[model samples]
Target: MLIDILTQRCNAQRLMIAEAYQSMYGRDLIGDLKEKLSDHFKDVMVGLMYSPPSYDAHELWHAMKGAGTEENCLIDILASRTNAEIFQMQEAYCLQYGSNLQEDIYSETSGHFRDTLMNLVQNIYKGKPVLILQGIREEGYTDPAMAAQDAMVLWEACQRKTGEHKTMLQMILCNKSYQQLWLVFQEFQNISGQDIVDAINECYDGYFQELLVAIVLCVRDKPAYFAYRLYSAIHDFGFHNKTVIRILIARSEIDLMNIRKRYKERYGKSLFHDIKNFASGHYEKALLAICAGDAEDY
Candidate 1:
């Protein structure tokens, strides 16, 4: 039914069905949406459905007040979506709601978390190999193969069980290109039957360890890993503050609820509860709104 509504060319038809479904059923049409769609079209529909009510100060204020903030939902919707859709959503969000989506997200989120999410939303390919090449060039290493080899070794350590090796891998993972890192990830997975994340958990410990593992897993199979990270950061890690902030802020616009469900299943805790406990300030509030899983944007 949700897909049927979304696939309609007429805006009135889509909105009418969506509003009617919400009114009569006393349930969000979005919750019913996942089962109705798949792939890029799902991405488009979900983004449109999960857009915040307004990107203006009033919406932010309401978000701050914990009434319909929809930050996590926005993040998941945006993150899983393609750059083109995000760009379109941003345009529509501003035109219809009278607010800039990027500015609003910037207002609601901060730090490296904000940076990473924004980078994604902007469709900045920071993860591309050219960025890695640039970094290598800055290091006075002209040979791509040499740089590639070093990157692979770091990735290898991230996969292997050696403490020193893992540490080295973590540094590279944190600093290197998502593009380069992604290649390295593919290489590592191919070389080892075990996933890199599994290797990280087996060999490393602590917040950094978890963060590194999260990044690895997110890069590997984003929806699945993010689902798990959202759960752990909120429920078990004492909100670990940073981790919750990092994952939520980074992925809120990306594929978080999928992460949320995975978190719920694996941890047996509500994703919202963890956010309520660990998150504080505007940031926390925004994330909580996101996890509630409303699909208003599409």
Candidate 2:
């Protein structure tokens, strides 16, 4: 009954049903599914039943649990989300695990990767301007002078003999509105004669480099950023299914069509083709459904 309803209902409705089941039965809906289902179906059902924050927290838990950390999972959840979304997940992580998400990430990882994740998860509750792409389109950029100043600050930060200024970089990335950052990036290119990604790559190393580059790409073009992420996740020695599922599910409604286009342009293969090749069975079917398109020829 749960599986049928879950497969048929939308995510919001399914969440409602899960809550109803828990309230009525006195057992967690996810716990029941774990008992009743097996394999990929179980994973899908359980994923579907979770509230987005709970699901993210659960993924973060598994990613950090054991001998090695799943850095990609951390990037996917921590890097891709908006500030408001991060705050909610932080709360959920604490509520679910009785521990701080930021501290947990720090304990599980080290150095630049830990710093990058910490920057993302902290200060998320601070009031920042809310602006989606469409909102930016409608409102346009407000401050060109500030953007130029920020661009200069970023250049100096990157140019320092030791390394980029951690606090300054974090402050700019965290505090600036997305729209403002978009302008800042353009100004950065104009002033530095190199894209931020190139500068980051030249100056930094390891996951910190990757994280900063991801932030720039996301600010410049989110769909393309995700497209690059999706490609790297699948085109590697072994496909990272967790990354694949997370990206597909997270962006299914937002800009996946654009992501698909970017993927084909960047990788010379369709995302659907990659999905069909890397995944199989119900998992494949579920991914293709969320993708909302058919496979394409290479």
Candidate 3:
């Protein structure tokens, strides 16, 4: 019943429904649902109630709230979002929590990896304006000479001291445009006889390494990056519900249609099949609703 109603209503419709329920019953709709729903299914229902930015803000709060940080959540949200989206999340975080998102993240994390996430959320990098390729339609402009120089820089960075390398990778990965990075990636391979992903794997460890790899993959193919995340959540970690929920719900109206195709191509099975197999009951139904498109396995 909950699945049927939510699956049928868009966010606006859901809000209207909430208002009608409140007026008719003289009780808060969300509060009632919260009291009733449990586990990941509850999370899905509640998440469906918030706007995307609001939901993201809530996730970041919870991620940073406990003693330890959910670094993957930070990386996934901060690194993958556009400058505009980050700004929106920043505002939402402030409005929802009455706290600065950067300060929250700052207190929770430290060192080079923290700085990279800061640059992303704070847009704090000074000097020359970095082209934001996350949401804009590229003019398809890329400088071959500049890419070669940057590629050489990365190769050289790999040889330098650890501090120097972290600084270099942070600058290149965070500031450069997508097309620029794509060219630099190819050049890096040609000059070094190794993939950039492999280079990061060789040089770095911890959250820093993971974030850099995620950035490279996102630049290469955002949907495919997400598809791989889904695969890991579903298979490698035994239906990591929060990760699955975040990706599917957040990307549903964005690039999920493409992500579905990429998942099938990469995994030799449909995302729907995997979700159906791994997740159960209303939880599976909710995820499938977000994932719904084609019925056939690829």
Candidate with best TM-score: 3
| 10 residues in a row with least lDDT, candidate 3 | 130-139
Candidate 3 per-residue lDDT, tens place, 49-134, comes to: 87778888999999999778889988888778876787678789999999999899889998998888876775444554435523
Clashes of 3: 0
**Per-residue error (Å), model 2, residue 251:** 2.6
For residue 244, model 1's alpha carbon misses the true position, in angstroms, by 15
* Candidate 2 structure quality by residue, lDDT tens digits, 1-298: 4444665566788778777887898878888888987776567767877777787888898889857988877876776677666767877888998988878888988875676677677643335543432111112345889989988888887888243575576557655677888888899999999988888789777777777777777767889999988888888747777778777766765688999999989888788888889888777777776677743433
Residue-level error in angstroms, candidate 2, position 75: 1.7
> How does residue 29 of candidate 3 score in lDDT?
78
| Model 2 misplaced regions, further than 4 Å | 1-8, 20-27, 39-41, 124-142, 161-164, 294-298
Which model scores highest in lDDT?
A: 3
Clashing pairs in 3: none
- TM-score to native of every candidate shown: 0.38, 0.83, 0.90
- The residue-by-residue lDDT of candidate 1 on 1-298, one tens digit each, is 3333443323345556668889999877666665666543343454445333222222233342464344544443433443344555555666665766667667776544454445544522445533221221122113445445755675566557465675566455544545556666655666666666676677666544545555666455677876665665556656544345445544555566677767667776667765656655544444554454443311
Error of 3 at 97 (Å): 0.4
Model 1, residue 234: distance off in Å is 9.4
